[model samples]
Target chain A: MKEHVHHLKDEEVNILLNDLLEQYGYDFTDYSFASVKRRLQRVYINDRFPSFAEFRYRVIRDSTYLTYLMEQITVNVTEMFRDPAFFQALRKQVLPVLATYPFIRIWHAGCSTGEEVYSMAILLQEMNLLHKSVIYATDINESVLEKARKGIFPLAYMQQYSQNYLQSGGQHDFSRYYAANYEYAKFSESLSEKIIFAAHNLVTDRSFNEFQLIICRNVLIYFNKDLQDKVLHLFSESLEQLGFLALGAKETLRFTTVAPLFKPLAQKEKIWRKIAT
Target chain B: MTVSLPRTLVIGGSAGSLDVLLQLLPSLDPACRLAIIIVLHRKSDNETLLSDLLATRSVLPVKEAEEKDLLRPGMVYVAPADYHLLIEPDGTLTLDYSEKVHYSRPSIDVTFSAAAEVFKERLACLLLSGANTDGADGLQMVQAMGGVTAVQDPGEAEVAFMPRHAMTVMQVDRVLKQKEMAEWVMSL
Candidate 1:
């Protein structure tokens, strides 16, 4: 049997969750606890904290550390045209409907680092609806939102993202969208022109506007059933009548309160249509 | 029937392993008081029928792992495709869509390390037939945490690199034959 370094107890994780909610008013209480605990554990262990008590103290005392901790806990892994079929569905099925509207408002709830938001922008630009579309790319983390606003990503990722774009029904040379300088690819200002990056915590923030389509993919999986339902309800209220909603491939509206209001627009693609009330 | 509760038997494999599972699952003790976890490197798209296929073979309830699912004894939880399956200190399973570790999303390393940290001595990890080296360091972590670690005998494995890799990293508790794999898990 080998010696164990400091391992976080189940109760200690609960204490940290409580501390987060009380000290900062960031309500991660309703996130899927298992995943949350695992992610928190990673931060705690990665930083080589000798004891749980000291780690808790650092989080409670240092505001900067708290923000860092918050970022670590949030599942920020996102990619351009992730699950490309979903994007294809957006291009082929949903966008045409949103194109009918004089002005298009697309809310990217929990749009971490804006990869999908940028993906959306590219789609809109291709459809010639970029002139009318305003993409609200909101994330809980201001830092990721900042990155999103810059519209620069690692040049290495461009190849795969380009592949995803082609799979998602992209026609033109994907390189036409961005300029690569050294190791970074800076997207054209034309695509970023219509996007508004803002800090919005799903747990605490209220819907600021209604939209023709709401894309909150892979975001709700981090949330527990109740939080998922609550956020889905928020999406439900924020969507315009006859609007479309898209979720992560694994996420569904079925068994959720919002399910009754939504009919699967592209069931395999996890797109739903909010039946006009 | 009254085996120790809350033990995690985490089995990891990639190629040439499903055949082992198809045979091993049916022989499992129906009332075995353990959370059986299967983390296979699988396809990310639809046709995720591994859990369903396993269910038909075993008497125990088998299902795809979902976000925030509490681990239960007398059941099997199969790691979903395209996501890393991680265990929490509170006995619930969580899924992540983070970047692929070792070029595999449901990387055996990711799940094994998480399960090892959470379960400690109560955890037992078994490495099986695979072509990749994903589970070696993770198996070492399980051993270092005072948990039990096992590998299918490389000689017996259809694809032996995975189990062979685990042996090179740390001293495993058991090097199981395909026939003894089920019995070994039951004994734990």
Candidate 2:
């Protein structure tokens, strides 16, 4: 076995990644170095290139490789009713606060492939809030946003999701949410009627609307501390006074500057209520 | 001359893997012919220093697996925190949005099961210390596909549930302490 040195230095990797993003308008420059490096290494290995320089050259010279790399780096891995306990907690703890509002604007940040966004829409519809709520589902990856807009997923995955929906206190049959044809399940367009799916980079993009509830789950963990702080601030700015902030079960704002600005609604589920200014 | 087919090793662990990886990797024989792929549950947003940290300890080339990278002998590939890492039949790496298994994106079961399907008899699946029983069924599937199965002895694991569950569900070929397991894998 041969020892390979830290061949791909952070600065070099950043320059290459930033160049690609700048040229292509895909803004992964603010993503954590670990993430950028891991993805780059994958691209490097797949293309059978021995060094980052070779990979960088190919990425710049070949548009096809660049597109393939973009797809590889941006595909969002998500599931319906992911973290069932969080959804259950939202139903039990946060829905009451949401119910008080006659109209609601909610943002599902980094809502990859629309699972959590659809999940929230389903929950809000059950509570009679969908008619009154508008959802803005945003992701940095256009490919994933496109999928989220389509609201379709593999039918083979539906059985497990059905169990998760029931466990999370879903009111209707899980099948009612979608129409299955062959291997694909297309969610009812009515469910996404209020949803506006768009490409928004947390690194380069600013908040578009004031939201009563901002749910950004499992997405923040890919960022570095500085990037995380920037995103948290974005969420804070996007949220309304005394609004709700929900994170994935494993994610928390306790260590950041944002912790002081929000009070915990359910600490275990990482549900927070923004401090009233 | 016909080139021998390369063997691939898939590992899954969580909670206390840093110490285990540190211990096990240094002891691995440099001449080992298999490519090791590891899934260590980590914070999705935090910087993973595992490759840098492990590269210093192991003689084998250590890297984070990338999409469509062909598997090479004596290389160690770590899965990125928030991505599902799967193996292609041609030994290349592929990333997918395939729904989370065991409540995790970079899940042990997802990689292990996918590798089992792709690599079949040339695969070796190992279950290590983890807080949950995420990889037991995947390891069983690997064994069912004629791949080798190994589990860390529960008493020696940092978190015993994962290896213990694997032991209960499947007849793993070996249950060794960390160092012994490393030696056993190299000998294979």
Candidate 3:
């Protein structure tokens, strides 16, 4: 299954990226080429394209196929409370500021399938801030956004997520947040009320609103340095003064154009606070 | 077959593998110009301080990888837990939080395959003591990419299942003795 499709040459990858941009206004040319090439090869095998030419032909000719292409080209791996320490830091360090605000606005950029959005909602509810908070969850892929809207996830994963919740200082019965429906757990509608899931492309779209807390985790590593700088600048612009920005465990704002504008709130956890002009 | 000497050495392990590394790391010659990467299955908690532990014994510097860091020679790198480490074509390191392969993030398969793709024949891989079969297919990919492959001899492995299982799926170039690993590494 690994090598059913021969390795994608550099020129072929450029061609595919160019085709996607020309036809759909989806610009992936700035994505990390090595990661993109690896994903492209996997897409070829999973979609059962007999050859690279066939894959390219279908992408150029069939708009419907582009949907699958879009979904496959981007990595969508996420989990609830993925790094508990980061969430714990949010509970201890960031939420107090949110509590001070009469109304809190949070953004989950590149929220894949909404796991972290739901996680954030749960966190706010624990702090008695859910009723006052509005969470805007956005992703580049519409399919994942659709899933995020449903508020259902695999029941088996709840155990792991529950552990994460406990580790993050959650006191309530973690099971209280969701009801198990056969193989899936459906989160309560109250949690979903605060969240608005939409498809927003970081590569192409401008900042839609100012956020007091913006969380984009493990999403920027796919991009090139230039694109990362552009997106980090966008995040800087989208933030309110002293807004909290939480990234993945290994991600950071250091060495980016926005570095001077933000200071680490929880340095080890990669949470940064926007500094004013 | 006398192929080009490999410049990158990626070692993968889980379960009882750390003991082997403690034994093997001290024996590595700093003069051997291979960029050594160690991938271990571990909890997200930093309680183990695995890199720090390895650094105490290694003749070379050992540190956890940060995103976009270049792979420099004569150094040791440990993959940060809960993320897959991928080597890009330009020899820069990148991290991915993709789905776990073999019920483990930082899966040996992810790093070995990505390094194989980039380093090709300039890569050499060693699979060590682990309870699961995570490193077998990765070893296979390394061999497929013309990289040298070695697995600890099941007899010498702390948990033989990993090496035994690896040997079943892939044709490795060497069945490494526990004490001779550093020597075998130097020979490359």
Candidate 4:
């Protein structure tokens, strides 16, 4: 006999997700619905729960499942120098503006596993500005935050990143940035010295400090318009006068509430500078 | 007489997929009864025109799967850009904005494993051309659930690591060219 498959309705899934998030205080209510629905579906199927209601009950009762759910919700798929051209643009345009400042505070928001944060630190070190720079690298995921703090990456992925680094106009041997032992590459403490990796949720958390530059690449796409606006406003408030903002190559400030507050530094690279108001 | 069971066809791929999908779509059996779900690795920000592009070539109705859309036979569903797409037990679609698996929001693993959980032995998983081995673990999970698994021949793939990795990790049911893969899906 042919067996029929049952499907959950969108309204039901939304209610379940909202309940779980609100009870858990994760604030996924503002994230893009399409994206959040898929993740929760995975959790539901993986656990062999018959329905989203069952899964939500399990989530409410089980602490470990809640942790797993949190990990599943906070996608942290970042790579070292994932987009070389963006880094190159940073070197060409933003660095010059940053050079004029006596001291700099840079924020790498949604800094999944700290790859971009380290990339920024290394760039600062080579430019002889590391001493004057303080980088706050943050993500909503604590597991990724711990990994970011450790500064270790698979040795195999380093060669590709090194290639990207060279193409982005690296001044020194990329190997100098890390020490390879066994299968892991531990980045130098000198680079780590300038960085503070922490847990922060852009959706729910408040802005920590005013920054000279905030590089939040590949993070905002997950957010819906309302949340994106709220986060952009937070960035606007957290950024000093004429401070710079860098987004993912595809992300833009054009449609958001804070759009009028920033002037494009390099439109193609998705880099913008805050306008003094 | 009992009606034939509806099958779930899961396709996972990454880099250089547009070319692969273009080639693979025309060979599919339009009359086949299975629901085809495609997981293509893509940037989260760009609008996906894949369904429109593939719809032109396929006899099956092609659309980017929306949240809560029921999975139906004779229709093709593509995962929307940047969002992981999974099937609910009742066959509706669920999108996940959760942290990326293997650095991808719409991770192949997320979808494949989710389908494997719901469909169990009725699922058919396929790995096509891609740069990373993102779908290997998911294929394994599908196989563990007694679902059928297929991999595109690395020799024929635009990027081979994805299928090649799946082949290395588990014994898949078939390694076929895109046309043969289409035929295999029809046979199931």
lDDT of each: 0.87, 0.79, 0.88, 0.80
Those runs of model 4 whose alpha carbons end farther than 4 Å from true positions after fitting are A1-12, A50-54, B1-188
Q: Scoring only the second chain, what is candidate 4's TM-score?
A: 0.93
User: Looking at candidate 4, what is the lDDT of residue B63?
Assistant: 90
lDDT of 4: 0.80
Interface RMSD of each: 2.9, 12.1, 2.5, 7.7
lDDT of candidate 3 at residue A265, scale 0 to 100: 84
Off by over 4 Å in 3: A1-5, B1-6, B46-48
Candidate 2 error regions (>4 Å): A1-12, A25-29, A47-54, A61-67, B1-188
Candidate 3 clash figure, as a count: 0
Q: Which residue pairs clash within candidate 3?
A: none
The per-candidate count of clashes, in order, stands at 0, 10, 0, 23
Candidate 3, residue B125: the lDDT equals 95
Q: Model 4 fnat?
A: 0.17
lDDT of 3 at A181: 91
- Candidate 2 chain A minimal-lDDT segment of 10 residues: A1-10
Error of 2 at B120 (Å): 30
Tens-place lDDT per residue, model 4, A167-273, is 88886789999999999999999999889888888978898899989999867766766787899999999999999999875577876778888899888678899
